[model samples]
Target chain A: MNYSNFKIPAVAVALGASLGGLVYGYVNEAISLALEAATPYVEQGFEVREDNWSGEVEPGKPLLVKHQLFRGNEYWFWAGTSWPGATIKVDIFDSEGNSVGLESFARDSFAGVRALPQKTATYLIRVVAEYSKTGEGLTDEERGANDPVEGVGEFSGSLDWGLVYGYR
Target chain B: MVMIENVIRIFGRAPLAGLGAVFVATLIFGAGLLNAENAPNAPERIDLSNFPGEMVEKVVVPIPAEIFAVLEKLDEPDWNSGIELPEQGDPVGERAILALTFGSLVGEGFIAVQAKNADEIQTIGKRVLALSEALGLAAAVRPHSLSIIEAAGNSDWKKVRDELDATQQTVRTTMEKLRDDELSGLVSLGGWLRGTNVVTSFISNSFSEDKAELLNQPGLIEHFRGLLDSMKGPSANSPQIRSISTGLARLEAIIAPSTEISEEDINQLRDISRTMLEEYYFEKKAAETGTSIN
Candidate 1:
C-alpha cells in the first residue's frame, strides 16, 4: 500500500478543517457575547431620585420629586426646592392617569418633607413650582411672569424628574 | 491473473469510495446543522436608528413623567387653589398611587438589573412592556374615575361615589394583574421592555410638546384604560421575574422620599444595590451552566 500520498493529504485536510471549525466557532461566539453584553444598557431606565429636579409648593399637595436616588423607586414630598414663605402645589396621578392624590406645602425649603412610596411606575406627578415672593400674592403680571421671583434663584426646569423602569 | 485478483480484492475490501461518501455526508450534515443554528444571523442589528428615536424617547421619558404625574395628582387636590392639606383625596386613589408607584419602581429597577447583569436589551424591553401594562391598568380604571369626576363636575355626589366604587373594583383587578406580572421569562422580558421603550418615549414627547401635562388629562386616562383592556388575558409569569424581583423591590423602596437619607446615604444604597446585583449574576451563571438559555 502506498501510504505516503493518502497519509499526507489526510493529515493536511484534517488540520485545515479543524482550524476552520475553530475560527468559525470563535467568531460567532464572540459576536454573540458582545451583542448580549450591550442589551441591558440599551434598554435600562434612569434611577429617578430627589436631586433630579427642583420645585415650589403651593398650599396644596406638595411637589413630590419621585426620584430614583437610592433605587429606581418613586418618592413624594411636599415641595422640592423653594424660597421661604413660598406656596407650592403637588399633584399625583396613577398608572391609569387619574388624579389620585394631592398635597400642598408653604415653606422656604421642603428639606424636611416626608418620603412616600418609592415604587416607580408609569405614574406621572407634576409639581406646580409656584411661589409668592412678592409681599402680596402673585399679581396677574407677576404670576404670568416667566422670570423667577425677586431674591429667589431661577426655578425653571424644576419639574425635572428621573425616568425609572426596568429594561432587558 | 493473481495480480488482477489481488487488485480486485484490495478494491473490494478497502471500500475507499464508500468511506469518501461518508466523509462528504458528515461534512454536509454537520455544516447544515451549524448553518441552521447560526441561521438567526444576529437578529439583523436591530437598526434602532430606524427604530424611531422618537419612539424610544416617548417610551423611556414618559415612564418617569407618567409616574410623576400620578404622584403629583395624588399630592395636590386643586391646581387653582394653592392649598396644602395632609390628606384631601379619595382613599382608593391613595392605594392606586402606591401600587402604581411600586410598579414604576419595579420597572426602573428592572432596567438597572439588566444593566448590571450583562443581559440582552430585550429584557429591558419586556420590562417597559410590564410597566406599560401597569400604565394600561391605570388607564383602564380611569373611565370609572372620569365618571366620578364628571359626575362631581355636574355636582352629582351619589353618582360620583358609585363610579368610585366601580373604579375600585377595576383597580383591584389591575393590581392582581400587576402582581402576576412581577417579571418573568426571558422572551417576555425582552419583547415587552423593547416595545415599552418605544411606547413611553412616544407618550412623553407628545405630552411634553404642545406643552401638555398629562397629569390629569382625560385623553391619557382613556389611553391607559384602552391599553389595559387590550392586554388583560396575557400571562406574565416567567423565570426572569423571580431573578429580578428583589432588586426591583429595593429600587422601589429607594425611590420613596426619605427623611433620613442624604447624598451620602443615597450613594451608599447605590453601592449596596450594585453588590447584590453582582452576586445575582454569579448565582445565575452557576445555575445556568447546563441549561439552554433559550
Candidate 2:
C-alpha cells in the first residue's frame, strides 16, 4: 500500500506513455494546420491568389509531389509535419533528382521551398518528415553534394503530414 | 541503496527497452514544449540546392485568381468586362457532367466575387449545393456553400471568394482521398476551362504580351494531357475526354517550351477553351433531353 514500492518503474512507464501521445497529437493535427497557414504567405509575398494542389503524406516514406509550374509564375511550395525532432524537407527536383529549385526553408515542423521555373516544366516536390538525430548539425551545403535522404534515419509507422503549394 | 540497485537492475535487465523508454519520454517532453504558445519553430525558407526532392505524379497548377491578382496590380482591370452570365440549363444529368458542372459553378462563383454581384453569387451558391448533392459530395461541400451564400448576403466578396476556393479544394481533396482521381481531374479541368475562357477573352480583346505571358502554362497543359491519358471507364472513352486530350496536346505544342505566348496562340487557346466549355454543357443538356449532339 506504500507509494515508494512502485516508484521508478511505474514512473518510467507513465512517462513513456505520456510522451508518445504528446508527439502523436502534434503529428496528427497541429503541424497540418501550420502547413495550411503557410499557404497565405505565398499569397501575400508573391501575389498568389488561389489554391493549386495539396495532399496528405506520412513520414519515413518520402512523397514526391509533382506540380506543373508555368514559365513566368513564381511559386512557393510548403510541407509540414508535427513530430517533435522530426525533420520536414520540401525540395524541387527533376526526374533524375537534379535541382529544379535552389532554395528550401525548413523549421522543426514545416518547410517551404520557392521555385521560379524559367520555362513550363513538370517538377517534383519531395516532402519528407522523419525522426532523426543526424540532420541537426548538417547544413544543406555540407549535404549539398550528397543525396538529401542520405542523412535521414529510419522511423516506421503511419503518421500524418501534408504539403500544399501556390504561385504568382 | 536497495532502491538504487533495483532501478539499475530494471534498466540493465532491459537495456534496449530502457533506451526506448527514454526516447519516448524525450519526444513527449519536446512535444509538450512545442505545443506551448509561441512555437519557436515557425517555418523558415529552405533553399538547399543539394536537397533532391522526389515528385508525385499528380500536378495542379495555380488558379485563375492568381493571374487576376497580378493583372489587378498591372492595371485597373474591368473585371466586369469579360464576365458573362452562364446560360442556366437544368443541372447536367450525368454524374461525370455534374462533377465538371460543379467545377464550372465554382469558377462562376469566383467571377461573381470579382464582379461583386450578390445575385449571381447566390444563384451559383445554390446550384453548387445541388450539384454537390448530385455528386454525392454533400457532406464535404455543404459548409462551403452555406458560407458562400452567407458571404454573398454580407457582401464580403473576399469571404465569398475564399469559400468558393474552399469548396473546390474540399471536393478535390475528398475525391482524391476516395481515390476518385479521374473525377478530381475533371473538377480541376472544368474550373480551369471556365477561368481560361474568361481570361482568354480578356487578353484577346486587350492583346498585351504582358497579359499573354500568364498563358505560358505548358506545365498545366502537360498535367492535363497526362490526366487524360490516365482516365479509365466510360469517363475515359467519353468523347468529351478524347477531345480534351487532343485539345490540350495541341495547346501544349503552342505553349510548350514556354516561349513567345503569341497573340495567335492566345486566340487559339481562347477558341479551344470556349468551344470545350460549350461542348461539355451542350452534351450534358443533350444527355438530359435524350437527344444526340451533331
Candidate 3:
C-alpha cells in the first residue's frame, strides 16, 4: 500500500475539516447556552436581541466588545461557551474603565452581568473564559489527578464563546 | 508539575519521549498566562486599536424606541408635538432613497407609538410596507407592518415598539445577507437622523440638561459617518448621501466638543437634522414633479 503520497493531503483534509466542524459546533452550542443563560432575564420582561456575537477565545484572555447602550433601560449581557469546565466572566464597563455592571453571575458554562447605564454612550462589555478542572463536577481524586500546577490545569486550547444581551 | 512528572514516569522507561511534549505544553500554557497577565485589568480601559482578542465587529445601533424610552423618564415632553406625519407621496424607487425612507418611516412609527396615535401609526405602517416593497423587502416586512397596524389598533404600544424594532432588524439583516451593506447603513442612518431630529426638537422646546444629554452620542455620529464614508458605487456619489456626510460632519463637530449639549446646541442639531430631511424629501419630490430644487 503506497500510503506515503496520500499522508500529507489526508492529514490536511482531516485537520481542516475537524477544525471547521469544531468551530461551527462550538459556536452553535455557545449561542444556545448563552440564550439559555438569558432565559431568566427574558422571563423577567427583558427583550432579548436577535443579534449575537460569537468567536474563539483563548483561555484567560479578555474579550472586549464596544456597544451602545441608552440610559433608562436596564440591560443584561450573557456570555456562554461549550468548553467543559469553563468559567465565563462577563461585565460592562464605561468609557473611562469604570465598572458599571450591577448584578453578575458566573458558573461553569455561562455567565451574565446587568447594567443600568448612567448615560447613553458607548459601553465596553468584557468577557473572559478560564478553565477549571474542579468545576466540572470532578471528584477530589479526579481533580488532583488532572490538576497540574497551582492555577493551571488541563489546557483546552482556544474556546468558542458567544455573547447575547437583553434590555427591559 | 505533578502532571509532567506523571507523564515522565509513564514514559520513563521510553527514553524521556514525553518530556518534550510536556515541555511544549508547559510553554504553551505559560504563554497563555503571560498573555493574561499582559491584559489590562477591569478598571483600566482597553485600547481598542491594539485589541488582541477577536472583536465582534457588529455594532447594533439602538432602535429609536430605546432612546424614546429613556426620554420618557427624564421629562414628559409632548411626544405628540414630535409626531409630524410626512406627506404621503409616491413610493420611492431608488433603493438608497427607499432604504432611507423606510428607516425614517420606522422612526415616525416610534413617534406615533409615543403619541399613541393609532391613525398615524396605521398610516406609517402602510407607508413602511410600500417602501419595503419598493426596496424588495415586502415579504419580510409585510408581517411586521401588519403587526404594527394591528398592535396600534389595539393600542398595544409596547408590541408596536417591538414590532418596529423587529422590522428594522429584519430589514438590516436581510440587506446584509443580500450584500446590500450600503442600503442597510442608509436605513440606520435615516432612522437616526429622524430620531435625532425629533429628540433635539423636543429638548430645544423644554431645554433640560438631562434630556439634552441624551443627544451626547458622538460615537453614533462617527458610526454613521463611517458608514457614509464606506458607501461605494453610484449611491456613494449621490448628492443625498454626500449631503448626509456633510451633515454628519457638522453634527460630529457640534457633539464631539462637549459632554453636555446646550440649548443652542440642541437647536442647531435639530435644525441640521430638519434641514437635511427637508432637503432630501424636497429633492425627491422635485425630481418626481420635474421641478428643480434650487
Which stretch of 10 consecutive residues in model 2 chain B shows the poorest summed lDDT? Answer: B285-294
Error of 2 at B83 (Å): 2.6
Residue A75's lDDT within candidate 3 is 86
The per-candidate count of clashes, in order, stands at 108, 10, 0
RMSD of each: 31.4, 18.2, 17.5
TM-score of each: 0.21, 0.67, 0.74
Q: Which candidate is the best by DockQ?
A: 3
Better of 2 and 3 by DockQ: 3
* TM-score for candidate 1: 0.21
The best-first sequence of candidates by TM-score reads 3, 2, 1
lDDT of 1 by residue, A20-60 (tens): 11111122221122122222222232122211222122233
Estimate every model's Cα lDDT from 0 to 1: 0.30, 0.61, 0.72
TM-score of chain B taken alone, every candidate: 0.20, 0.75, 0.78
lDDT of 3 by residue, A40-148 (tens): 5555567676556777777888888889887666788888876656668787888876788755677677888778777778898988887645456876655664576
User: What lDDT tens digits, residue by residue, belong to model 2 across residues B42-147?
Assistant: 2233333444443455465556676565455334456665555566666656666677778877877776677788888888888898888888888878877898
Q: Is candidate 2 or candidate 3 better by TM-score?
A: 3
Q: Model 3, stretches more than 4 Å misplaced?
A: A1-29, A83-85, A130-158, B1-54, B281-294
Q: Write the per-residue lDDT of candidate 1 for residues B1-294, one digit (tens) a residue.
A: 433332222223347654664466456434423312111111212232242211111211223223323323223212212111111122232222334332333333333322232122223223323333544554554454445445545555334333332333343334444664222122122222222332223233223211112221222223332333333332212232332344334433543432333333333333333333332221223322111110
